[model samples]
Target: MAPVPKTMSGILIEEVGGPEVLQWKTDLPVPELKDGEILVKNEFIGINYIDTYLRTGLYKAPLPLITGREAAGYVVASSSPDFKEGDRVTYLADHSYAEFTAVPDVSAVIVPDDFSTEQAAAALLQGLTALTLIREAAGIKQQLGISQGPFVLVHAAAGGTGLLLVQILAVNGAKVIGTASTPEKLALTKENGAAWVINSKEEDVTARVKEITSGNGVDVIFDGVGKATFDANFDIIARKGTVISFGNASGAVGPVDLFKLTPKNAKLVRPTLFNYITTKEERRAFTEELFELISSGKVKLRIHDVYPLKDVARAHQDLEGRKTTGKLLLKV
Candidate 1:
């Protein structure tokens, strides 16, 4: 193997404030690969909304932290037998806003020849989250007493995970109601199998859902837009329905009175990503399922914009402003 570099450039969160806080520096040292760890030369890094939370102090992280959740690349060095030099892989790891990163061997998956490096990076974090959201969190099939299809409502339906959720639901025969703010996004949702799309800005979510479902309400709601959509969930959810509160893109959801759900006969669930894919076995299963879906053409990925690593601040700016669509990536 070639000699490892002494320094690398990355976007650092010196002190959280806004996109302006992401300081790009060339003096950051390349991390050392320890036992059971692999060093990756990143080719593609994904920008998720959660990264914005950390940057804006909505979610706290240690000072001077590198701010990327996932990336794909070739293994440059390894200390574990499970991976070798030059193996193409992708992982959900901390400190990925750089040219190279070190992650525990257990955290990465080998990229199959059929899968490109960009595809792997784009799919890991969001793809698995989508899989669990549909098959586990919502449990629509079990709740509706059917395997083929169930009624579902998804907020921010044009998002990376939202788009995948809609695709997965459509493939499994589920009828979905997606909410987006604009006509373009709503059109994308419709193309992806959303039977009805709600322009949350222009229309009342509850009223539209009632008109579409004919007053019975939806079987489940996968909500990531916290405060803006939380109240509407209770208004539209069916009796015994499940609300998966997975994210807070609009704003953090405030205090809730549990009694509110009692009237609707519904329940709220917040499924954490770490809890779902904790073990290597679980991660492998998710990767296998996700990869199979993509390889077989059952799923597709949309690359919104590929920003250069040096332009991370603008990437953060655009992502935070909600000016971009689908998956936003940083070319490492």
Candidate 2:
């Protein structure tokens, strides 16, 4: 292995506003490992909507931050015995839009022998988000009770995390109804195992969902579209159903009355992936299940594009514009 360099290439955000704030620099300092952290030479970084939120000041972070949540690469230095130099890993961490990241041992997982760094990067964050959204956030199994398969709805069904949700829900035998604005995305959703796809652009989503569910409404709603689709989720959710609002792709939802969920006894939850995998055991369990699904061909991750680190601004532009579908990655 090469000696670790003091300086590395990365995107540094000094101001918060738009994609333009993501300025690429060659002289950014490589992060130093903490006692329980490992230094990874990042090969590929995952681009998520959270990155966009942090970049635009929608989500708060300090100035001059290196903003990204996940990356996959080879460990180059370690402050813990669980990892060593040359171990391939994918991790959930801070400051990932860079050539290297200091990853907490609790949040990092070794990439399996069958997976590539690109796959690991693309799959980890969004994949686990999908898993935890279904299992932890929604509690699909317990919610289903004796029902063989529950009716579930996923907003932005062709998007990165949306696609994963559709596939994983299908694998668990849910009848998934996915929403997309375009025919291409609707088709993509169906291809990924959605039992039905709603063209959120042209159709009345609430009416269509009512008709599909025979007026019972869906058992669970995985809503990542945020404010744009939040209200409709209540209208289309069945009695005692769960609504997991996991992202703010269409902007954050406003204050809730809490009374809206009262009529149907609906359950509303806003879960962040990080909260679900706080401990090492939790992270490892979810990550292992996600990897097993991918490796077994039960779930597939779609990489929309791999942008150069310097081109992160354009990537963010495409993401916020809703111009691309599936996972976006940055090659370091």
Candidate 3:
């Protein structure tokens, strides 16, 4: 392996506003490894809505921050025995919008030889989000009362995480209802595993959902559209159902009235992926399952575009505009 560099190139956010604030710098200091840390020379970085959240100040972080949550690369230096030079890896960590990142040993997972770095980068964060949502946030598999698999509603069903949710839910025998705005997105949602698709742009989502469910409402809703779709969840959720609100693509949900869930005996969950995999054992188990799904062709990935590091502003613009579908990546 080549010697680790003293400085690296990456996007730095000095002020929170818009994509224009993602300033690219060639002389940013390379992160130094602390105990149990691995220094990764990033090859590909995953672009997530959370990155935009941080960039726009919707999610707060200190100024002059290097903002990104995940990246796939090869190790260049390590302070832990778990990783060695040239070991390919993908990890969840801060400051991933860079050429190199200092990742905690517990957060980094070694990439199997057969899994390309691109696949690892594209699948790690969003893939895990889907898996954890079904298995942890909603605990679909443990709901023994729902014998025939619960009816699931996945908003943005053609997007990166939504597609995974549809596939996994269908594979587990759940009847899935996916919502997307465009015809192309709706068709893609159907192709992925949705039993029904609703065009949120043209149709009344609540009424369509009611019609599809024969007026019983859905048993579970995976709503990432936040404020725009939050209230409607209560209107469509069945008795004893779960509503998992995991993202804020439109805007953050306002204060909730716990009373809203009372009428249906419903449950609301606001979960983050990190909380679901807090230990090495938990991380390994979830990651192994996700990888198996990918290898078995049950969970196929769709890369919307791989932007050059210098074009990150355009990448963010496209994402915020909802102009692209599937995962966006940055080649470092």
Candidate 4:
């Protein structure tokens, strides 16, 4: 085993505010390992929208909290026999924006031999998110219902989870339509297997979607942009369509009227990843599917950018400002 560093660096939020609230310090102690836990010497940390919500206080946390959710690293110490020193692992959990992390053994998954640390860091959260939304949330069962052909519309098509979801749907033989803000993003969406791409900023999304589906709308819509696109999202669904409202990147969505769904006989559901993988059994099942997808090349991990761990504030600013197109990571 390599000698572990005595102290580690981390990003801290002093108060809930703008990007200015992010502070970095070098003197923090490495997280102490607990029973059933392993200490990881983090090599890369994932930058996600949830991290931004935590920093801005939109999602409340204990004041003066370390902020980060996903990271990939080598195990340095452990109380559990499942992981040994020098094993490569990754996890999606809070408090990972540091040089070292003490994570429960169950929460961490060993990276496959084919994947690098960077890919492991970028894939865990978004890949799992995509898996849950498709298999669990939207319920893509053994056979897709629509003989006319099943269509899935994904908002924020160029994002991490969106890209993965598009591929997953495509491999499952669904006609996938995606919405993005720029031509570049639209092209990326197409590269990721979207059958159709709509520039939601410049194009009338509802009109384009209707035109693409020949006025029938789609069978399922995976919406994460929230308030900014919810109305248009609602307008584009077919009768008996299913809408899965997952994340709020633009802002919180409506206090929706259940009556609205009655007119179209549609179903409205709000799903979080936590609910989908509620039990240990469910977690294993979902993750196994996700790993199989990646290992089999049915899904590809898109890494948009990588920055030093100390550049967490810049990463947050880029993501919140909508300046990035795919997954972002911090190289520790």
Candidate 5:
């Protein structure tokens, strides 16, 4: 093995506050590789709203932690048989804010020959999240099932995962109703496949969805905006509809009253993406389907912004401020 570096530059959150809490440091040691782990020299890191949750203590993390969950890079050293030096891969791991990360080989996906590291970093985690929503949450397992033309509602329609959801649902024959705040976002959502785009700021989502669905209500509702959109989401949901609240960008959706599921008997599932793909096989299924969509051009991602790794705090600020539309990245 080539000489391992003893230190690297990365952001560390010593205290949980606002974006200002993020601290940059150069003397932090490159994490030691453990059994079954491969060390990657990261070239691109994904910036997610979840990272802001971790940074601001909305979600608990070990204090004084490197905070990030996705990146793409080349393997530098490995103790595992699955990877070798110079293999291009996308890594889904904790503490991915650094220039170098020691990650489990099972948690990494080999980047396709056609993709750049930045592309992999931008799509892997968000795409997997979108896949799980449609496949498991929406209960559209087979092609024929989707051809039935289910009604689907996607909140934050122009978001990184929302755009993919719209395209996937549209490609699978679902009638999509997407909600966004700005004209640009609404237009993007409409172009991607939304049958209707509701300006949540200027219009009532439940009313517009009811008008479009003929009062039957949508069969599937995907809400990543959490508290800000929960009441509207539940209001517009159909009988026995499947609803998933996977993120808390606006604020955490507090405890649910089971009574809320009463009249309609709808299903509400609050899930964490990382927990769903713990095994290698589970990971493979998500990546395989996601890569298939990307390779065939059924889905695409836009790079909203690229900041140097040290500019991570600014990335978080933009994310929390809702100043971005597509995927955000940190160039390492």
Candidate 6:
């Protein structure tokens, strides 16, 4: 093990704005561990759309915030019995874009021996999100009631969570349709097990979806694009189809008419990872399933880029510019 630094470098966002607000500082104090906390020397940090939201003021947090939500590393010190020095772990928690981070032992998941730190960090958050959506939110069953075949639509198909969602839905025997903006992204989505890939920019999404399903439409649409894709999603779902709108990458989805549900007997649900894994039991189940999937090679991490900790602002810029095809990371 390398000698722990007394002061660590981190990306600090003093105000919510554009990428310019993310300032890298090298002299920040190494966060001290509280009781039941473990100090991890972060090897890789996950960059996500939610991080972009926080940077752009779409998702508000305290000003002058240390702005990272996921990472993987080895425990350097521990005040918790569950973890000890040198145990490799990954977590979806705040303030992860640093050389060292203190996280509650309960919040950290032990990475399998064969998994690299970078792979663990890249996969954990998105994998867990996919698990919650497929197993809990959508209530995917052995046989979906009233639906002849399970068909699902996933928006932002090239993204971290979206790619995992594609694989998970496919493994559950659902015909998965994924949407992406470019040919490269579409190829990536297809490689991840999507049965169909729609170019949201070129195709008339609803018409294509109708044509694909022979006009019956799909059983479920997992939309994270919010305003830009919601209407098309509504148009293409089969009667009583469930629309799971989980994010707002385009912009915040403001309001909708309750009567919209009455016409087709359709339903809409807004689910967050926080809600699905709220309890320890639920969190444990979710992680265990995800770990099994990854270990068995049923799912793989789509890590598109890894930047040094000092270049976090550039990572955020790439994320905001929509240049990334999959999960981005910060090497700490």
Candidate 4's C-alpha lDDT?
0.86
Q: How close is candidate 2 to the true structure, as a TM-score?
A: 0.97
**Tens digits of per-residue lDDT for model 6, 206-305:** 8888989999888899988898888777788899999999888889887898777776789899988988877778888888888888889888777899
C-alpha lDDT of all candidate models, in order = 0.87, 0.92, 0.92, 0.86, 0.88, 0.86
Q: Candidate 1 on 284-331: residue-level lDDT in tens?
A: 887898899889988898888899998998988887676776898999
Which pairs clash (backbone N, Cα, C closer than 3 Å) in model 3? none
Cα lDDT tens digits, model 3, 173-267, are 78899999899999999999899999999999999999988999999999988988999999999999999999999999999999999999999
TM-score (all chains, Cα) for each model: 0.96, 0.97, 0.97, 0.95, 0.97, 0.95
How big is the positional error of residue 20 in model 4, measured in Å on the Cα after superposition? 1.7
Q: List the residue pairs that clash in candidate 4.
A: none
List candidate 5 segments past 4 Å from native: 142-147
Residue range 119-215, candidate 2, lDDT tens digits: 9999999999999988998776433422478999999999999999999998888989999999999999999999889999999999999999999
Model 5, C-alpha of 315: deviation from truth (Å): 0.9
- Residue pair clashes in candidate 1: none
The CA root-mean-square deviation of candidate 2, after full C-alpha superposition on the true structure, stands at 1.7
User: What's the residue-level lDDT of 15 in candidate 6?
Assistant: 81
Total clashes in model 3, counting residue pairs 3 or more apart in sequence or in different chains: 0
In model 3, how large is the Cα lDDT of residue 23? 94
How would you encode candidate 4's per-residue C-alpha lDDT over 1-332 as one tens digit per residue?
76888898888888998877888889888887788999998999988888888888878999888888889999999899889998999987779988888898878888889889988898888888888888877887544522434888999999888898888888877789999999999999999889899998899899999999999999899998889988776689999999998888998885887777876898988888877777768777877788888889878888889998777778888888778887999987
Query: Backbone clashes in each candidate structure, one number apiece?
Result: 0, 0, 0, 0, 0, 0
